[model samples]
Target: MTHQTTPTMLDTDVLIVGAGPVGMALALDLRYRGIRFSILDASDGTVVHPKVGTVGPRSMELFRRWGVAGRIRDAGWPGDHPLDIAWVTAVGGHEIHRLPFGTTDTRPPLPYTPEPEQVCPQHWLSPLLAREVGVHPEGPLRRECRVDGFRQDPDGVTAWATDLRTRERMTVRARYLVACDGASSSLRKAAGIPAPSRHATRVFRNILFRAPQLRRQLGARGALVHFLTQPPALRFPLRSMDGRELYRLTVAASGHAGNRDLDEDALAMVRAAIAFDTPLQIVSENVWYLTHRVARRFRSGRVLLAGDAAHTLSPSGGFGMNTGICDAADLGWKLAADLAGWAGPGLLDSYDTERRPVAERSLEEANVNLMRTMARELPKEILLNSEDGARARAELAKELERGGVRGEFEAPDVHFGFRYASDLVVGDGDSDSDSDGDGDGDWRTDAVPGGRAPHAWLDEGTSTLDLFGQGFRLLSFTDEPAAPPTALAALTTAFADRRVPLGTTRCHDASVAALYGKPHVLVRPDGHVAWRGTQLPADPGRLADTVRGAR
Candidate 1:
């Protein structure tokens, strides 16, 4: 577990800490932009628990940009395992509500995005990305390295790190330091940024184990995620990780009372969730506190926070890692712009203004999902006797009907519906109107203002998401100007001349044109629309400066 260590001074445009999905993702973006950067992680390059089970549609779209989406799709998750979200009294117990989203093969083609979410968990995903990024001896990825401290200058940052194996200290000087570290980020705390909780915190434990016969034992009852509802012991998900022997069971830590050793008792808790008797081997156990929190700020001098470092939310809606991936993408381009010297002055600061609100919204939505589960009152009759078992079943069904349990599992809105309300976004003066022309000021569900440009199928094999992978894309209709106004083209050329990695494309499709609500739409490198206008702006230099953060 040790590697040869030679004294060295490493220099790069950016130094990224934490090699989780978000850190690796930021590395991928920086690589594509041709930005010189290094990534460091404390652990030797291996993933455990894989807390993240599914890649959200938006995150998958970004992966497609990185040229790894196809590999992720081909990852070993069973093609036929049910992708549906099912709620029940137990794994084999009474089924209450089911959102039957078809498996990867059975689902109909989506018009908007080619990369409809896949079931690849983190353990499978992390290695594939690491391989593509190339962890050579002097490559940007430095495994088994831990960042201990960093100091920032007006122009750059000097970071000190330790080799976990050799215990040798080293220094890295870079223009910027990005902390993609997890929620309990030592770096964020070291930088003196406080992440105050927005709501009460709750603790839970995840148990990863192998159950070879569990899937077959359950037979037709096998599901991607099974929520256990029994009280006092298990009340969380028993999910199938990759449909093999691997599985994850989440249980409330509070149920353990004060017991420190989690052995047979923990196994028995998992056993109670399923109706079938199958052999199981416990792999690893992790106890984590779920908090709804957003850091007071995301940036400090030359050091910036991304991913779990910036915000942490309940996993009820599965937005934890996806939010971080989006953060990497947003910060990737802005950092590249700044490094390349074409970025506007305020570009980096906008990262906080635009992303903080989205994190707040995600926190609120996830808390709502958690409340739905926490508020359920287990009926006394259900726990009472065999004599009133039939009456208990009736009461359970009634409660399920009123409980709206499906929100816990099927939250497409949280995954894809967030919009940015930043100073850079240009509105058509109708940003508050709904689809029906009602000015309700309800922006969450409404697709106006800064919402993600809708998805549409452009061809038999391609989707609108496919068009935006490599760089900044400008999707315009044929009726609009054949080329962007001269000013816009000048800005594009300026960034391109400096090797900033931006691209512009025009889409003549009638459907995409309508979805974007403007003739010319400028999408950022991360696929979020940065600027949109009914007609090309008169001064392309000003627009470019605005988009590139020059203004």
Candidate 2:
């Protein structure tokens, strides 16, 4: 007699552990690349509470590429509503410094990227992204499915998961495995990856509530976020979760300086934060820890970590989720290339070399924003309605301006300015790219190698950003009557011979050419400039090798 074992198989090239925004974003990107994947979530496919408030511009650009930006943009957030961030004693209380960010409809068109920021919270965003990747049991996304464990060999990863509802066992064989299992990622732990804390971890309580009349009361005075400048552990953002009745108030659950505070009721906390006597109902509350931890490495063998699994940061600037989404975008293309048998020996290695540094930078920057709110002096009298109160408000406004608080609300460089410096990226002259924010602008656009290719409107309804993503794009600039150099014309054959999908776009616009800083620029599938030069290289295969991480 023989005991036979049958393993439930998945028709998947990549196995994704977790169906959070980061995992879903990776799925969406992989779907865009026409790759086969299976994404599993332990919990049901319902976003009961949302944490992330706003999606950054760069994330929007990637979402635009994935074909869900329109759905996100039109996902019921009022276009005429104010996008401002206001500091107040409460929602209807004394107004202090208000950063007058005009309504999305009224704000002047930005010169940088096509898609700007949107106020779509995670609860709404999660379903939208999940649907984009498909949610059926037979489809890529599997709701109520939990990945218990996985083992990665040199050739592939074998993940063991179970259907939570049925108590059924399953096996997923894949070329690669991505762990988006969140901050306390068990897979990351099982893989023995170290993500040491970069800053002191603090606990916070998010109180989700519905103030039905709060929107009416805050009508003209309504801002996206109301920073309650209360003293001690109470100072945090009371945000408009849905731009409507729904709102969330964040409070420090942990006592000041690590003291324990019992009897910290959620209702009492909400009342203390909101000065207005508006009708508000407590929906639910979730307590979470804000830790700054970046993994030493994003990849271990055939398994990779994305999102909170790779790095966890303070959400003061809303960079945590956006950073994770960008990680998915970066990894998706490389994973696709590897699966399609076109990836170079070192292509996948560049994922950590590029994204890990960005995570560290975002972590440090988010901490700065957190400290700005934490270390702020509340002056108990800022809430008073008297002359002393007015003076206190006026003084505090000046201090905030001098403190560079605007960096938290308007950080474009944090999103668009990171440059990949690895063996794959061919630097023209200097390794440094446009990373510093130039005062008013969140990011300065420059076409230096290793940076995001600068955006330009080639024609109405067409952007230069649309030129990349599918494959390696060569922006072969031709000076009107003069044709492309013979070497430039021959580059396509070299790339094709190596099975690298390379496309050429001849640009006559000198302004567009000037923004790129080089006559010919190679844009990677992730929309970053891989190489740039005055003319085509003598050996185009070497250029391909350099960009593809073969060399």
Candidate 3:
């Protein structure tokens, strides 16, 4: 007596769950690779309480590849605002230490990167990415749609969702399913991948407010972040969210609570941090848990995890979102390779092997930063203006100097220092060689296998990094060119036979050659070095096959 109907099927090469910055980043990468993918999110694409404050330099480089770096740089943050990090007894009170990072417009160019970090808070970043991903009816983005459940087989994944607005049920059939959902990913739990916490989970509160005249009042005393040293509750950061009037103050949640205790007054906390009266309007207050977690596995069968779904770390060093963004970049090309059929079985598997370690390393670094703040002993005497207070301030300053607080704000190494070691990367096998030195060497100068290719200025406006992203790029130094006519022919034919995209560029720059530490360097799509040598391999076909994941 019942009528049966076939479910509506929406097919795509990839289905992305969650529309956060990491998911949007994956969408951008897939779009650039000419891959068909759809994004799903339950809520409308609006970032109400922006959690991310800064996009790291490496992430900015990836954004540059996606054609949105320029827009992110110009996202409305004032160019003249101080980027300094100041430690103070209170906002308008005695300053303990100041680490001066010049404003965006006046900062000297970094020798290691073409793009530096940008402060585009999630509120401004979300709409920009959503527009770039296309929010039209016929587009790949599906907002206000919640996926109730999904099932995956060897062939593909079938996910069914109901449009929250229209109540229309639909099914998405995709070759791969990526969970970019937050720290608490339902998909990850469904897949039985446990992201066990590595450290004790702590709760914190973020109060976002608008202080229209505060910037004008403070003037030159203003800084990007004001680390308050007030005893008991106010030993946290009050950061300028948008360089102008917007700001966010972080405070510890009340005793023995984890994001559930709402007893702390937000206004009082804000007032306690700022030592002066100003026109203030509270925007929103949020309670979030800081957990250091890394999933047991980054991939399970056809289901892959990226971003916070795979790991979650403290926001101390601003590495949480940046780490996830890098995950998207690493997973994007591997997914593309698998979908395109050029990927060997291990190529996709290498994603788990490579990215999981980086997440773990970042977790440790972030925990160090978090622990440093938690371990600090802030005395009430630091707040006084008397001689005793000055001594206390000086002693605290000395402790701050010894504690290395600058690492929290200015660790380019944390942003760009990671090296990827996997089966896909071909090591040169010379442990004693300068290029193959142990991991303690400076990352900026090493072109070691499984490391990011060093950046060198190709032109006034272009970097060596600009040559990567789309496919494998082989850079041959003219001083000791890796490929002769025959070698070039063999290499071209080898990669062409497998239909792997490869681009070759011959460079005559001695400086670049020295920076790379090799005459020939093979860089991956994600801008990590796959292999480097003084000359081409004996079997170009084998080299191609190895890097392409055939072996």
Candidate 1, which segments miss by more than 4 Å at Cα? 1-6, 255-264, 380-391, 433-449, 469-471, 478-504
lDDT of 1 by residue, 367-404 (tens): 88788777776654553446585577567667766776
TM-score of model 2 vs. true structure = 0.95
Model 3 residue 240 CA deviation in Å? 0.7
Stretches of model 3 off by over 4 angstroms after superposition: 1-7, 255-261, 432-438, 480-482
Q: Write the per-residue lDDT of candidate 2 for residues 1-551, one digit (tens) a residue.
A: 99665757885788898998899999989989999888888888777778988889999999988888899998889888889989888777888889999998999978898999999998888888877787775477888888888877878988888888877888888888999999999999999999998888887878899988887877888999888888776678889888879999888776443345524777888888777687879998777778899999999989999999999999978899999999999999999998888889899999999999899989999999999888898898787889999999999989989998888999888888777778888767743543322223212546776778888999998899999889999886757443455686678878987889998898988888777777788999999888888878889989888887799
Residues 1-551, candidate 3, lDDT per residue (tens digit)? 99666666799999999999999999999999999999999888877788999999999999999999999999899999999999998897899999999899999999898999999999999999998899748678889988888998999999999889878888999999999988999999998999999999887888999999999999889999999998666888999999889999988876454334456667877888888999888999887888889999999898999999999999989998998999999999999998888888889888888889889988998999989998899988888879999999999999999999999998888787777777788888856322422266456776888888889998888899999999999999855444578888898889999988899999988889889888888999999999888788779999888887889
Candidate 2 segments whose C-alpha is farther than 4 A from its true place: 1-7, 255-262, 430-443, 480-485
Q: Give per-model TM-scores.
A: 0.90, 0.95, 0.96
Give each model's whole-structure lDDT. Answer: 0.76, 0.85, 0.88
- Scored against the true structure, residue 519 in model 3 reaches a CA lDDT of 83
Global CA lDDT of candidate 1, please?
Answer: 0.76
Which residue pairs clash in candidate 3? Answer: none
